[model samples]
Target: MAPARKKVVIEGSVSCVYCVMEGGPGSVIKTDLLPGAVVKLQCNNSRKGSWEEQTKTGGKGDFSFTPVKVSSRGAHKCRVFLVSSPRGVCPLIISDGAVLKPAPPNATSPFQLFTLQPLYFYPAPYTCL
Candidate 1:
């Protein structure tokens, strides 16, 4: 007989801060806002539903997704992907391995909330032709 699997829910937020400084002279700084950016979640187990699900950032660059079912035997892994950027500035997913703690059989939430690492954007140096 096979053992029963547990239900789990995963959620997190995506946000970034853009800053600009003076090329020379003094230090003049400015922060650019990121909103409406598309982010996708990748799940190892397909039974939880579609492996490729997407969501968008809110006005404050916050995003989350629906819950998913995880396997009991193995450590389930899910990766975050960047679909598109509103300002044409794509950021990299720097989050390391995020492991979810198994839920209790009679758990109320049966879920885990992880803190996603910040996405960083590095400007490319320019050279005049």
Candidate 2:
């Protein structure tokens, strides 16, 4: 029998700012994730600086922070926390923030948010069988 393959996963994203600054809309949430999971957006921008924001998914299998504060810095990461999923997944904080404007509070989606990942989910590759 073929070796049991672990599903390709990305999760419980967290990181520490080595030498960084949060520009405008910093990394706040996971916009795409494995299905049947609860993606949680959490971060520690500074030792004392703190902010709280949240939004849930509806089995849509995609995550993204809405109404984020767009940012640009040397190394500050906008990471994702895979709240309730398998571990050792890819770093949701894949790269630096995009040069796009953040979503307005009156917006309905993350379309305009400055994102590091593709705003759309291609779930066809990962089937949780």
Candidate 2 lDDT over 1-129, as tens digits, reads: 742212111212223222222331242333333444444444446643545444444444554554244232211334443344332342223233222222233233323333333322212222221
For each candidate, what TM-score against the reference?
A: 0.54, 0.32
Per-model tally of clashing residue pairs: 0, 15
Residue 43 in candidate 2, Cα distance off native in Å: 3.2
Task: Give the Å error, residue 120, model 2.
Answer: 16
Number of the top TM-score candidate: 1
- Model 1 vs. true fold: TM: 0.54
Cα lDDT computed for each candidate against the true fold: 0.49, 0.33
Worst 10 residues of 1 by lDDT: 120-129
**Model 1 misplaced stretches (Cα beyond 4 Å):** 1-9, 15-33, 46-50, 69-75, 89-108, 126-129
